[model samples]
Target: MYENCLKGHSALVTGSARRLGRAVALELARAGADVIIHCNSSKAEAEAVKKEAIALGVDATVLSADFSVDGGAEGLIEAAFEVAPDLNLLVNSASVFPSNRLAEVTLGDINSNVLVNAWAPFVLSRSFAARAKSGSIVNMLDSRITDFDHSHAAYHMSKHMLALLTRLSAMEFAPSVAVNGVAPGLVLPPVDMDAKGGAADAQYLAGMASGLPLKKHGEPEDVAKAVLFLLASSFITGQIIYVDGGRHIRGGE
Candidate 1:
């Protein structure tokens, strides 16, 4: 359904190496949008995504950055424009999920989470709006932001901040730039886990699914579909699409 929907447009999907981010980028390419794949330390995987996008008949490139570094978003925005002068979509999908209870969370953990998950996306959205004639943004979030995750104190806090940022940027960038968010639950294994979908990770998700409304986990493509919907939308902004199979609304997801 998205074929030629985004023809002539361009996008940048941060952390578009091998997980949910990669799925989002590939979907954009399938819709005929040239894309810049952003990564922190997944160059080889990012390159593979770029090749996949290129195979889909759209321009693709990789831009890496250390999002924890101050002002890092500025360079990413610069490179996005350079790679695709008509860059119009920014997908803030790169994030770090650290497990730490509130009592045990360290200053560094808080700092890192806030910088990459919250600050980087905020800065990139601001800059993208400043330069683009018209475009859209999609920030990746966790469904737990609506409730809470005691085991992921810093991560949850940063996601809450990003949710607010999405609303603020949507209000601020109105009439020109559209800002939105996609919150996923039990979609992919954490970066620290066996990304190859090992037995342990599958068992964990299988167990996690038992508590969700759908009684099952979601796929990266689910979130990617939500992103594409938001991008194709013209009257939607300051909104969030949760790809958690009713988990966010039904509770116990």
Candidate 2:
């Protein structure tokens, strides 16, 4: 709702091709910031988002990166810097949500979860700090990190690691880069559910919302608003704003 709040800033938002990442990038663009959109395999989708951002009267571009590959995060940072030479904001939003219980989790699952969710964000944060005069980072996290999710053992663990990095990086990058996170809960449909009309998924979400204190789910825009707040704040750091519709206050997930 703020106007031209980020007039002089530029941002690179990973996974900006769709969903929550797209929302965050657009939110920043609406606030008057040039955006560098990043996606791994969604070039066409990313281009669409870039057009929308450009329509907001801000410079926008797209970059592709595979965070699961070696040196991928570094390559993303380098390529982004080449485009936005004065980049001052980073949104680490690219993530994979694979469902696997503890006994069912494979080494491949663990590595992928850690690489994309935690390791990639850390690498980008470090790289951003080394070059920026002043910046802010908003890591997309899960509210499940506060309690636990047995259904996604590896994914939960990786998000827990990301939450810790949010705090630690704020300290390490002190006075230069402010690190924060936005923990979302029951926001959007999962990838598999997105393509087809998810009647069953809608029913599941309706049932799940009953357990939450607010008795409702959230939207991608809610998480975007949280990211925008952290980006605009100069005094807030090392904190996570849970945009979970009060679900996090429940005893356990």
Candidate 3:
């Protein structure tokens, strides 16, 4: 269904090295968008994703920047424009998820989390609005932002900030650019987990999924598809699609 939906469009997907970001990049390529794959320290993996997108017949290249560093977001945007001047789409998917409770979280933890997770996206969105004559942006958010995540306090706070930015940006960049977000629930395993999906982590995720309305989990492509839907639409703006299997609304029950 996504075939050629984004013809003539060019996108820069942050964190495209692996996981959900990788999935979104591939899906965009399948839909016929030239893509710029951004990675921090995953250049090798990003190269692989670039190859995959090129194999799909889309112009693909890899850009690297550490979002945790100052000016990283701005630098990446400048570099992307240098590579794809017609670039009109931005996917702010790169984020840091350091686990710590609010009571125990350090100031450094808060700074790092907010800088990478929230500030970076904010900068990218601003840069895109200024450069891209017209296009759209998809910010990757978390379903947990609707509530609290005591176990990941700083990360949760940053996501809340990003959610607010999504709405404000949609309003700020309206008519010229559409800004939206996708909040995914139990999709892929945590980045810290074993790449091969260990049994213990599988059981843990299963237990978590059992309580969701869907009583199951989702895949990275599920979130990627929702992103593509937003990117392909002309009327959607300032909206957050919960690709969370009803987890965000579970409290209502």
Candidate 4:
């Protein structure tokens, strides 16, 4: 909505290869921000998104890092600064969601989920604060943080950790960097739910949305708009905008 509001900013959006991350990167580019798209192994997809962002009339590039590894987050931040030293915006949009109930969740599952979903974002945020003089950070969170997702116990725990990090980081980075989050519910189906060589079933998604208070699911644009809104503002900090069509209010499983 705020056209060219981020004209001079440079952004690094993790997991920008596809889905919501792709939407956020393109949206930022539309607002005139130079974008660096990051992906774990989807360099091809990231390159395509880069083309889209460049077509938006802003400088764009692609970077890759494995958040599952030890130095991945730190390395990614270093790489981002190498490309855009004036970088000022960071969006922690990459995450891994595993489907395992609490009773069935293994230590390995917890370790992997937390590494990518929580630990990496923390490392990235810390690295960003240390390098940038002033900027904004938005961590993508799940609306399910307020409730239990019995089928995604590991993922749920990781998001809750991230939610805490968002608030604490805001206070820590205050008066210089604004730290906030966007919690989305049912905006897109989980990657694991996708059928072989196809997207997730539309009918299944529609059925899922019927339980939400709005009785409908949201689009990527809805979440992107929230991210842009947070990035455009200098006053708002430590707040989480829910783009979940009020599903968070119901605290569904």
**How does each model score on lDDT?**
0.90, 0.91, 0.92, 0.94
Worst 10 residues of 3 by lDDT: 192-201
- Cα displacement (Å) at residue 139, model 1: 0.7
Report the C-alpha lDDT of model 1 over 53-78, residue by residue, as the tens digit: 99999999899998988768899899
Q: Order the candidates by TM-score, highest first — what do you get?
A: 4, 3, 2, 1
- Per-residue CA lDDT of model 4 for 1-253, tens digit only, reads 6899999999999999999999999999999999999999999999999999999999999999999988999999999999999999999999998799999989999999999999999999999998899999999998998878889999999999999999999999888999999999887777788544324456666888999989998989899999999999989999999999888899886
lDDT of 2 by residue, 137-253 (tens): 999998898787888899989999999999999999999899999999878766645435467767777877888899998888988988998999999999999998887798455
Least well predicted 10-residue stretch by lDDT in candidate 1: 188-197
Predicted candidate 1, C-alpha RMSD? 1.5
Candidate 3's residue-wise lDDT over 3-39, tens digit each? 8999999999999999999999999999999999999
Best by TM-score: 4
Q: Please list the residue runs of candidate 2 whose C-alpha ends up more than 4 Å from where it truly belongs after superposition.
A: 192-195, 198-201
Once model 1 is optimally superposed onto the true structure by TM-score, how far is the C-alpha of residue 9 displaced, in angstroms?
0.5
Deviation from native of the Cα of residue 137 in model 2, angstroms: 0.7
Model 3 earns a TM-score of 0.96
Q: What's the TM-score of each model vs. the native?
A: 0.95, 0.96, 0.96, 0.97
lDDT of 2 at 214: 93
Give the Cα RMSD of candidate 3.
1.7
* Model 1 ranges with Cα > 4 A deviation: 194-196
Model 4's number of clashes is 0
